[model samples]
Target: MRYLVRDRMLAFHEEAWVETEHRQRLFKVNRKLLRLRTTFDFVDTEGRQMASIVKKALTFHHTILIKQDGENVGRISKRKFRIFGDRYKVTLRGGRRLRIAGNLWDREFDIADDSGTLAHISRRWFTIRDAYAIDVMSEPDWLLLVILAVCVDHIIEDREGEQLTNL
Candidate 1:
């Protein structure tokens, strides 16, 4: 399946939607306001919290914790060393290591592990700047993967001083 995401105007509190190719809203990413740390909450269309990514304020590496039901389900951080410049490493709660590598800042990349490539994410300029199209392959945990991609996007944006929600 393919989905689209659009960039939001610069704001301390930002909001955007994860939608299907047909433009149906799937999830909402909310960067909460007045928080000590940057937090992006994912919610279903019905307004139920699906997951959240909370940035670590003082970590040596750029790190964020993925939480569902108030429990950490995964963690993503920048790899100190990369043989080929793939910057982020995702460690799932169940001991799965997912590697993300490609033209990341350009919004094109792949998420993969020992098994194989899981998904391809790339920016699609559909008359709107900073739009992304995510093509999911045979991964059963596609939702998490989508959230993961968005989480990475959020982190990258923060790094570039685009949306410094924590401030």
Candidate 2:
């Protein structure tokens, strides 16, 4: 399964639409404003809350929590002391661990589980705003994948902002 994630144009708040390859809406990503830590809510087309991604406050590394129905289902956190490309750990609820390794700058990466590559994410898809393509090879964990994509974008943006200030 694959999906197209696109950001809304000219919006004050962060908003995006998660659609099928045929342009059918599947989910909505809305950033909650005025919060201490960055947060996003993912809702189904019927307007039902599906999951949420929240950045942890005051963390040394980029840490994000994925919650479904108010329960922590997974997490995306940066690996420590990495000098090369970006790395992240995705821990599912039942202690299963997945590794996220890729180049954040190019917004291309792959997630692997014990069996093998579970999904591949790439921003090669053309769009007016930031957009990406998610190719799911295995059984789909839709919300988790979406949150990971958003987290990657935020992590890269934050790093760029820091570099700008240091200049």
Model 2: lDDT to the true structure: 0.82
Assess candidate 1 and give its TM-score to the true structure. Answer: 0.87
| Top TM-score model | 2
Model 2 TM-score (2 dp): 0.91
Candidate 2 root-mean-square deviation in Å: 1.6
Candidate 2 C-alpha lDDT tens digits along 1-167: 88788988789998999887789998899999888988989999899998898988888877889888899988889964688878888888899999888866788888888898887888877655478888877755765776677777777777788889999
Clashes of each: 0, 0
lDDT tens string, model 1, 41-119? 9899999999999998878878889999999999999954456765788999989899888887687888888888888
- What is candidate 1's CA lDDT for residue 120? 87
Clashing pairs in 1: none
Every candidate's CA RMSD: 3.4, 1.6
Residue 50 in model 1: lDDT: 94
